[model samples]
Target: MKMRKARTPIIGKLPLRKGTIGFRLFLYTEASKRSAEVKKYAKASRIIIYFIDRSPHLVTGNNIELISLQFLHRQSFTEKIEQLSEEYDILAIVGTVQFEYNDIPYFSLIDIFNDDHLKKLNSIICKDEPYSEMIQTLENHLTMVPSVSRLVQRLRKVIVNLELQLNVNLKEDIVIGMILHMAFLVENMKLQQPGRIFPNMEEYYNSHKEEIAKVKEVLKDIEIEYDIKLTDGEIAYICQMCLENQQL
Candidate 1:
């Protein structure tokens, strides 16, 4: 008798290409004197802040580099855009109203500036809900910078405590929580210095073995219930792989 061959499962390709959403932000001020004034204050304070949540991918690369040159000596916005367009594949440009500068609030920049221009910028940069939410969240949170760090620390502690109380394994919930925590921290760090190193999963796990073991045990129970044959590490790795693929 002839044996039947098992059919291979076909994987569907994702529609979005990797790195296609890449963008560069150009902050175009009106004049040289104004640009110099802004730069001087920014340097002295060592804090360049915006309410908009600019993507780290764009801010760290050639996008910022080209814009910085134009802003350094007060070149025209047109010149800055020209230079940036030449260097990178600019997906969009956004114009943000400086509602606050160095903690001094300015409420009328949006009204004073060209609303149509701002709208055009918004149309280009605004892609997904997450992107819009991130920007709005950043803007709201910027006003509370005095409590931001402490608030984040407290939230992380609360999440960790909840994980313990729920008897949720550190390898799964705790590790995932820490990953999110680190991502936030990295994003904060990048606001100051672009392209800073972020925390690694292996390093985080190695430092918290006891917690990881607890997570592993809980995951084991879950695996048994689901009839999944994967080890804890394998499960985590698969999750990460799936997330990475989805982002592309």
Candidate 2:
């Protein structure tokens, strides 16, 4: 039998132009902010790259370079944001730090990552592009990693049960986001490493006990099936995702 070489996984590739005649998006992250935002943007940036898929018309080349400034400089940066907005004809701002620009459209870090909300961003960036199809392609590329693909399938079942118990339908994007988070989380647990620690989780869990309990029940089977356990903080984070979906 002949041996076949394994193909490398597709991560994502950046576009080829600079601040040219196309939609410009500013990804802002503060130096003093939580590392989580930085990490989130890293994931988001990769997704954006997948979205572009080397298309020339989606986003300018410089879009990948994050804008990092100090918190104290925010007051002065308002004028700067306006300048960049005019200079680049920036269509939208997506970032961790909130900007005070009243004229420009701004989407928080969370908004750009979600499927339902990403549509809003898509409309702004490129209306002709098929949003759902692009997202599906993105998911397909991400799941090329064998572990992520397996975990995503398992997490989908857990999320479906969660929706039934909560009586709330999560959008495709939210479901995908939850699955990705859970997949990585389980991977972490399998390695005997602690996942993200939700700050003041005790108080948060106490206040939202009823909601968290439902999430716990839905997740119990998955934990046993995977032969791993979820930390309280991790469960609380999952509970928060459910609550957010409910609100939507």
Candidate 3:
């Protein structure tokens, strides 16, 4: 996240520790004046992206702290990346910014690496170019908040569908929470078997019958689309979310 004055690499990779959920941005440029001499220096670095979930860390660490520690020890950061590639899932490769290769998906530096917004890290080094925001957006995608994660890509459909079905224009956090809740429902609906009673649903149904009805309609549509039936209790649970999202 810290900027180096020397024009080394214009694109910045994600600043992440071991066991974190994100990726490293590797830059590739068609050999220009600065990089023409370096061996294996294509225009851009082929990035093998990965994401892993772990127990949350304290939100107090800075990206530079890790880099400074690595500098002090004179450790090879590339070696660490190799180790991690073996340890975790390699999600995908980031193809060129403009071209859509047959195998690799393209990513843009302006969205993922910029400093103006979505600051998972406190800083971004656009000394010439930046890549952190790009990786953070990818992280959001892997985390199921695809609206922020992919930056106006396929998740826009998910947003539009949810809004249309549920009849609410959700704020970002609510959208995230709703998707996560849906994920949980999908995972556990079979085990939980959905007949267990929660009194909150009854209160919600009594007070907000209209939203409760909307939840049933939406859930029916979801069942038809996804080919999975949600129990009445599940419908009620999401109906409660509808009420909450409306308040937000």
**Each candidate's lDDT (Cα)?**
0.35, 0.57, 0.37
Residue ranges of candidate 2 with Cα displaced over 4 Å: 1-149
* TM-score sort, best first: 2, 3, 1
Worst 10 residues of 1 by lDDT: 99-108
Q: Please give the lDDT score at residue 69 for candidate 1.
A: 31
Candidate 1 lDDT over 1-248, as tens digits, reads: 12112122121122233333333333333223576666654542222224233433223322222232323332354465545444443332222333211111112224213443333233333333443344445446454133333233233333333243233323333333443443353345335533333247577557655655544543443233223343345434423432333211
Clashing pairs in 1: 169-215, 170-215
Relative to the unseen true structure, what is the C-alpha lDDT of residue 142 in candidate 2, on a scale of 0 to 100?
A: 51
Worst 10 residues of 3 by lDDT: 64-73
Q: Name the candidate, 2 or 3, with the larger TM-score value.
A: 2
lDDT of 2: 0.57
lDDT of 2 at 184: 66
Q: Between candidates 1 and 3, which one is better according to lDDT? A: 3
lDDT of 2 at 246: 62
lDDT of 3 by residue, 157-242 (tens): 33333354454555556655665556445435434445446577666668877766655654553344334577767667666665
Clash tally, candidates in order: 2, 0, 14
Error of 1 at 186 (Å): 46
RMSD of 2: 19.0
